[model samples]
Target: MPTKKELLTNPIQHIDIKQHNVVPLVDAMANMAYSSRDLNRAAKIYEMMLLDKDCGVILCLAGSLISAGLKQIFVDLIRNNMVDAIVSTGANIVDQDFFEALGFKHWIASEEYKYGAHDADLRDLAIDRIYDTFIDEDELRICDDTTKIIADSLEPRAYSSREFIHAMGAYLVKNGKTPANGGADSIVLAAYEKNVPIFCPAFSDCSAGFGLVAHQHHRSAAGKPMVAIDSAKDFYELTKIKLENPVTGLLMVGGGVPKNFAQDIVVAAEVLLGDDADVAMHKYAIQITVADSRDGALSGSTLKEASSWGKVDLAWEQMVYAEATMALPLITGYAFHKEAHAARTGKNFATMLEPVTA
Candidate 1:
């Protein structure tokens, strides 16, 4: 058996969207057919979303994108004001993004090890695999412990995932785990600095969950209070952004809770606004995914289908049935290089909703 050091030598280098100007390439694809055409349209709609001053763009991230080397794209999105808010899986935010912020790295797994063929060997070596990526189990435990430390430092109360994540941003800043401090740039740090809110509806499903579990267990045994995550608060806070902004857009990568959570905010705003039919569904939307709609799953559900539920508007919605890795960079790159965000000033919705959330 190879040593753990040998197995994890080559770190996964994040793809920097800024390095490659894909504007001309994406624009060229506009004249092509099939998924290429869909991608072009999606990219155009994203540009429209950015140009619309009244529209707030919410990025919904699912799947294991950060580990797949898309972290820089998201960080760039936050920095450039292209994305106003984010809704994502806990694994992306906690296990992946925040994990890297702690100075750990995801390694590249050899193709030969992808299909469970070496999973047992990986486990025995204290390694975890995410398709083509590898993470150190020991380092992940450190991430878990760091969460517990943050939890321990917090007052006993129920916090929305947004709040907890915000605290994480604060932690990063205080401990010099941010780019400004010579550390790596991270989604959490960028969102914090930009006043962009990030929500993880299923916040307890990742490494942070393990940390919280340990925290609660320790606190309970000591007859002391402990911190908790309030998922409803996540829903309420996100819904508030929709109600206040009114005009919204979605750029969804893959799907699951983040996708559904972002879409449901429209209906949620309607309900909160006393069933205001004119409250407006998401004005523009784009989803990129490899899942099949035939599965009847939320991930595969068409944007047109969402209109029936009064979530997305069919007119400006497009479902690019493609993998996120393939579609995201093109769409975002087109918008970036074409200067779509030139006229955009992020809504700073996190600041807008701060008082209520705090």
Candidate 2:
């Protein structure tokens, strides 16, 4: 059994799409078969979204993508106007992205410890695992406490996850947790600076939940008003994005709540519009996943199936049946290199959503 320090010495470095030009490689895959061809088309669709001046691109995240070294890909997208708005699982926003914004890191666990052979020993040492990645539990507690601090600073009222996450970005800026301040670049910080809105519909399921629990308890004990999360407001605000930008696209990595939540906004928009709705469905859609639709789960379901619900348009939708980590960098990196001719720029959706600032 190795000491925790020895086990966690190697940190996972995020992949930077800016540093690599993958245009030729992805372009060559145009002639390939199976998932390769699918990925090639998916990348082209994303490029189309970028080139379309009227489209607002929403990036959806699920799984431990940031911890798996995909954080810089998102940061680059946010900074470069490649992505307009974001919908993600709480773990991606709080425990993974925001936690790292505070200058912590996800470490690489050796293969020997990845088989659950040393998990108990890991728990004893206050270490947590996300697949082969390691996060120091002690550092994560600080992330929780920092959320409590942010909660304590806010006016005690129900806030949509977008509003709260905007505050998180503000917190990072005020504390110098940005590349300019020599701390670190992060998805949250970049989105803040770029005025990109990030929504975590299941807002309290991550480290923020523990912090909010502490916040509520302390406030109750002291007989004071407490901050609260409004998931309904999260849905409403995101739906407003759909209403505000009728021409929209989705680039989803993995699936689950974020996938369903982003897709459902189209239906939610139609519900709000009633007679005036143009049967609003996400205009361009791409999903990179390894899930099987046979499971009957939301993640595995096809975009064409979503069209049956009036949530997605079947004409421009593509499902690349591959794992995100392997597929995402190629897709986004391809877009980054081929972005010279794109007419679309940052929508500044956060400013459109509300006046929350960092």
RMSD of each: 1.4, 1.3
C-alpha TM-score for every candidate: 0.98, 0.98
**Model 1 TM:** 0.98
Clashes of each: 0, 0
TM-score of 2: 0.98
lDDT of each prediction vs. the true structure?
0.92, 0.91
Model 1 agreement with the true structure over 1-358: per-residue lDDT tens digits = 7889998999988888888899888889889999999999999999999988899999999999999999999999999999999999999999999999999999998889888898888989999999988999999999999999999988899998998999999999989997777799999999999999999999999999999999999999999999999999899999989888899999999999999999998888878768536788899999999999998999999999999998988889999999888889999988998898987787888886653232
lDDT of 1: 0.92
Instruction: Tell me how far candidate 2 lies from the true structure as C-alpha RMSD in angstroms.
Output: 1.3
Q: Highest lDDT: give the candidate number.
A: 1
